[model samples]
Every structure is written in structure tokens, then in C-alpha cells.
Target: MKGPIAILGARSLLGRHVVNIFQELHPDVCLEMWTQSDGVGNVNSVKRLIACISEAELIINCHEARDLSMAPDREALHFHNEQFVAEVLRNSTAPIIHISSTLVQCSDFWPNTYEPEREASKYGIALAVKAYCKSKHLAEQELFASHRSAVVLRIPFLYGEEDWGSPVTDAVMAANIFGSIPNIGDRGGAFQIIIVGDDTPVGDVYDNVVEAVAKNPKRPMSTYNLPFLPLYYIYLAIGWLLLAVNKIFDVSGSLSKMPDPSLLYLIFHHWTFFNTNKSTNLLPDHEELSREYVVKKSRDHYALMNPNRVRTSWQLHIE
Candidate 1:
């Protein structure tokens, strides 16, 4: 009999969705979920983690400190992002799948290669973002050093019904409340954005993890950037206009508030995007979602959550 698959950080935005999907799709598989409340992120809790996963055949680590504002200091970032990973590797022998960020790949240069020594300063990325990136990079290094069977999925900006604080979610929230999106930047950089719920990249993430668990490939480590729809910063202006129109016609009588500027640093600088050729080659049957479909699906999901809100004229036309 196979042991259960343990998911650490099971309460996260991605973690919750993964759990739900697994239950719905593969109900026969046993799953153990651990979150911050379970002391999963605490270095002292490694012993507890070891005990919990002792009977596990696979461990999926969705734990991460992603919010730039929340993880303000370097030590905090290192503790959550890198140190915890090292601790897990030291104790666990189970095949692991780690959820990493594409920010680790940010560079001003095109065709960014995997260079551990790459500095964030070269791309003029902000200090907080830089620290977060460095920590994720170090965590990856820790995994690689262990020479264990692990798969790292580097994902980009993710938005969904439950997502908040992320760039995409922030924009949506700001638009709904203030009728204006905060200034992101001069619109010079390239980016990729993906939805996290229902027939989106969340399924793709599951597919990759399933493949890793089944194959249990005997390589030191393998990394893949999940597929995404490429988007430029300039396209935000159109979204802003649509959001403003929706707010103006909203009958909910909700007063507008000022937009929060906390996440501005993440987008205020020029940053490069990832090339997912490796992921494509590996998942040849994977279908890429069109940008229009993603946008409409995301817009509808958020709109349904706030049912009193009216759709913009432009949005209706597009629909």
C-alpha cells in the first residue's frame, strides 16, 4: 500500500486550490495537509514535520513567503523561504515537489539562463523584491545540493477567487474600490499572468505534480516554468478603464477608497519574464489558454463574488 501524499502549507491560496482539486479528481488518494498554524514554517517545527511525513510517499511543499510587504526583512525571508526548505531536505527522504516563483528568474537580459550568481541590482529591482528573489533562489540551491528527487515549478503572477495581495488581485481590488488602478510603472517590462482556479493553470500544476509522483525520475533535480499567457505592462490601461466604468455604474453604494501602494514596488521597475519551452516539451499535450479566455474568466469570477457590481459597457461588448 502507498503512503499518503503530504502537502505542507496547505492553507495557502495555491495550497487550498490544490487540495480541493485533488479531492475532486483523485478521491482515492490519501492526503495530509499542514499549514503555518501547524508550525510548518517554524524551524523548530522540523521535528514535527518529520513525524507527520514519516509515512508519506510524496511531499508537496507549497509553503512560501511571497508577499513583499509581509516579509519586509531579509532574515524573515530567509527563514521562511530558504531555511525551512533546508530543514525539510535534511529530515525528509520522500520525493518532493516545491512551489517556487518566477521572480527567481528575473533579469534585465533576455533569454535569462539559470545563473545562481545573478544579482537583482542589475535589473534595478527594488530591495524587498530582491530579497524575496534571493531567498527563493537560495531555497532552490538547497534542493539541488541535496541531490534528491524533487521538481520545482516556477510560476508567475497568479490571481483567483481567493487570491489577494498579488499584483493581479490587488489591481482588481483597487479597481473595484477606488475606480482607478494604482500606477504600476512606465509599462516597460514583460510579464506572464495565470489564473489559479477552475480549468486554469491550477490543473496544469496538478498534472505536472502527478507526473513527478508517477515517474519518480532519478535525476538530482528538475525545474520547469509553468506555462502562462505573456502580457505587457501597457495592457493595464485598458483594464483600468473598464474597471472605472464598472465602479461608476455600481449600485451597491460602496464608497470608494484610496488604492494601497504597498505592492507598487514589485511592478515599478523593469523586469524580464520566463520562457517555458522546457515545460512545453515535457508536457507536450498541455494546452495553452488564450489571453481573452483568461481575462473573461477572471473578470467574471470576481464580478460574481461582488454581485451588486455592474459590468462596464466595454466589458459587455467584449462578452
Candidate 2:
């Protein structure tokens, strides 16, 4: 008999979706959600988390600090997981699938290889972003070292319908409604936006998680990046310019009410994209996500939900 599949950090945006998908996929399989803070109905304590983990057949770690600014505080960045992850590895005989980022592949220096299996993230020191990358690198190293059954998914630039506040959502809304967007830097700058286009949808990630749970391997400790999305910054840039103009004029544009000049540079200026050949070959259900489809879906959904609303920040009120 298979034990229940426990999802850590189930209160997260991705975590909530995964929980719903898993229930629909396997109604007979018991599902448990755990959060560091008070969870859905009751307060999920450390004891409860451990108990649930002890009995679960599998664990999926969706607990990640999305804010890159927390890099200065190492403990907070790791989420006090020095013993938590190790504890899980020690207690559970089941495979643990951890959600990681493609930033770990980035080097503190430069001339970084987009490949993850190459072990290119050797350097780790700098600003909040670099520190965040280093934390992920070290975490993965420890996880692989601790348990061979552990698996890591290095996702890059995730966008989906559930997150209506994402930068992509802002760009799409501004484009479809206001026809205005802003460029963070000079148009003719030498900084070429090189994204692996590994912008996977949450739905695809959900499917991969379901598959991993179904096939619980004994010695399956490995990290895999989701399929890549090709670079399409030009189209986005045009959209931003339109939104930026509307913002400057103080129009009733949806994105105009939000931040001006856009925050797309956070990703466009950097190269955290990854090579997904391994994930595509390994995960049979893995598919190359269509950036257009995702953007359209997010745009349409947000328009319907908040036709007159505009968001300046992608902040969430976690309980």
C-alpha cells in the first residue's frame, strides 16, 4: 500500500496548484499540505510536519524564497534548512523532489555554461542575486550528497495563469489593454537578453511532479531543468514601450498604474536560462511550453478577474 504523498510548503503559489492537481490525478491517494507558518485550517507545527513526513511515501519541496533580496541573510535564504532537509532525508525512505532554480548554474565570475551537469557554478559571492544563486548551488550539493533518491528540478522564469501579478502578466495586460510598456535600459545597449526560454508553465511542472510520484525510484538522485522557451524579448520590449508611455501620461491603463519603466530587466539583463535536453529526455511527459500560450492565458484570466485593477508589486499575503 502506498502512503500519502506529503507536499511541503503547500501554501505557496506553486504548492497550492500542485496540491489541487495531485488530488485530481489520484483521488484515492491521500495528500497532505505543510507550511512553516500556520497552514490552511490549523497551525502546522514542526512535530506535525515531521510526523507527516515520517509516514509519507514521497515528499515534494515547493518551499522557496522567491524574493532574491534575502541573499544577505544566509540562514533566511536557506530557510533554516540545515537540519530540516537532512532530517527529511534521514526519516523518509521515499524519493524527495526539491524545487530549485536555474540560477545555480550561474557563475559569480562570468562566461557561465548554460549546462547544469557541467558543475559550472563554482564561484559564489556578490549581490543579493548572486548570493541567492550560491545558496541554491550549495543546497543542491548537500541534497545530492545526503541522499541518492533525492531529485531536484531547476526551473527558470516560471509564468502561469494562477500568478496574475507576475511581471509577464503586467507586460501582457499593459500590451493588450494599454498598448504601452517600458524598457529598463537603453534600446541599443550591448547587454543582449539571452534567456534559455526555459519559461515553463506551472501546469507542466504539475504534470512532472505527478509523474515523479508515480515512478518512485530507489536510486534516482539527480537534478533536471524544465524544457526551455526560446528568447522573445523583442516583442515584450515593444509592449513595454507602449505601457511606459501610458504610465508617463497617467492614463487609465492597467499597467500604467503599476511600476513605470517595467521590472523586466531583473531577468532580461541576466542569463539564468538553462539547457533542458536532460529533462526532455528523462521526463517523458516534459514538453516545451509555448510562451505565447502562457502569456495569453494569464492575460485573459487577469483581464476577466481584474479588468480595472493594476498591481505595482507581486506581493502575496501568506498566512
Candidate 3:
């Protein structure tokens, strides 16, 4: 058997993408999707989630309410997730993979270098990231305490088709036909990226989850940032080009909408992080890391998207 499978909160934007990928990988497989959409802010919503955990052999939870604008009821969300993991460990034997975010990575980065450990920006965006870390940590710890088979895949910033208003989404939207970017005073801090590919770093996170399920062993939880090839400079160049285009054509073209306080700053500041080195050690023999491979893949992806005013990639793919 490839595996027993289930996904929670499968109706959300991210959840839908997850579902699409899972199905694409395994056709003819029964995929059960559960949502806490109605009355999700209450305890009963989570109780429904706990009940569903009882019947599954493997569960991948991609549930989240990420909004930088509104302060979430962190305690409520934390309690619900914590209890859900606790219940899964207590009643069922299946392993679980909980989706987390790079917002949780705490690393330092040196100004003159890409030494994240030495010069981390985790603190820079720390406040914006706190609640996500707290809730995910609560649930992860319980999975460990109960000796459950589970892993947490802390995804960094994701850039792909079908994402609307995502950090990259705005940039992709704002790309100008002039092949130039307007001068924007501020450049955003760096966020780590995870490149999706076959036999990917995800294999590492899943290996642990699968092993835990098979062994019923208590494992120490660790985090890895699936670093991408495009550094902060790549995004900065894209920003510069946009400003130049706006200057040349006297048009915003596909550039991002300027927010009232500052449109460009808001777009530039949104970032995520991850380190895949740790995960690299755990993958099966079939997959290997190649910096060149990822860069090539990403470059092709950007070209295919074609950041030109003539083609509406945003409307076609990102909405």
C-alpha cells in the first residue's frame, strides 16, 4: 500500500493546492477532505476534527488562518490544534504531517554576508510570526510526548500559480511591460523559499513521519528551511525593473498596487524562510540536491509565467 491518507481543512486556498498535488501524485486514490470552516472559531469545530482523526491511518493537516492584517485568537487556534494532535496520538496509530510555515524559523543573518545563522532576520519579522510558531509548537510537542508517529513540514514562502495576493503574486502582478521597475526606497528583508520537485526535501519530513508511524517511537522534532536559489537580490532586481518600466511608460502595467501608507514597501516586506540541509540527509537514495537544478527550474518557471503586460499570467493562474 502506498499509504492511508486524509487531509484536514482541505477547502482553503493552500489546502486545495495540497489536494491537487496529492491527487496528481496518486490517481484513483480515495482522498478525504475535512473542513472546520463553519463555527471553526469554537471548540466544537476542533472536536469534529478530533473525531475524524479516529478513522484515518495517515493525516496531513494543512489547516491555518494566516492573515497579517488581523490579530488571530492564537490561544483558540493553538488549543484546537494541540488537542487534535493529542487526540490523534491517543486514539489512532497513524502518523501525521502537520503543515507549518517558515515564519517559525529563527535564524540570524550577517549584513555583509548570507550567513543566516550569523545574521538572522527571524527577529526582524518575529512579531509577525509569533502566533504561528506558538500554535504549531504546541501541537508538535504533544505528538512527541505521546510517542506518536508524526512530522511537521514547516513550509517557507510559496510562489506558484493560483496564489492570489501572495507576496510573489503581487510582484508577478506588478511586472511592467517596459522591462523596468520604478525606484522604490525600501527593499524587503529576505525570506527563505522551498523549491518543489520530485523526491524533494519533503521526502525528509515524510520519512520521519512514516518511520514514526511504523516504529511508534518518540522523536525529537527538528526544523529545516528548504532554501531556494533566488536570493533577496533576485527579488530586488525584479522590483527595480518594475519601477524603471513605470518611469519609462508612465504606466503601472502589471506592477503591484501601491498601498496607502506605502504599496511598494508592503509588497517588498512579505517574506518566508527555510533550511533544507537537515532534510537533505534524510531523503531516499533516489533524490539529491542540486543548486543549479533548482535555479534552472525556477528560471524556466518565471519565463513560462512571462512577466509581461501582454500576457495576463496573474489573471490566468494567480487570480
lDDT of each: 0.54, 0.49, 0.46
Each candidate's root-mean-square deviation in Å? 14.0, 12.8, 13.9
lDDT of 1 at 227: 20
Off by over 4 Å in 3: 38-51, 69-72, 79-84, 87-91, 107-128, 170-189, 195-273, 278-319
Worst 10 residues of 2 by lDDT: 186-195
TM-score for all models, in order of appearance: 0.62, 0.60, 0.52
lDDT of 3 by residue, 61-162 (tens): 776554222233455555455655565566567787777654444422212122222122345543333454566556666666777677776655454333
Q: For residues 1-319, what per-residue lDDT tens digits would candidate 1 score against the true structure?
A: 2359888888877788778867866788898877777664455566677776777888988887653432134666678888888877877798888888776666533434433334445566533345567788889878978999988877765665565434444434444554544343344433344566322322222232212221122211224332221223333354355457656675212211222122232344334345565544532242464545655655555544441343221110000
Candidate with best lDDT: 1
**Worst-scoring 10-residue span by lDDT in model 3:** 208-217
* lDDT for residue 206 in candidate 2, whole number 0-100: 21
Task: Assess candidate 2 and give its lDDT.
Answer: 0.49
For model 1, the superposed segments whose C-alpha errors exceed 4 Å read 40-47, 69-71, 108-128, 182-189, 197-271, 281-297, 304-319
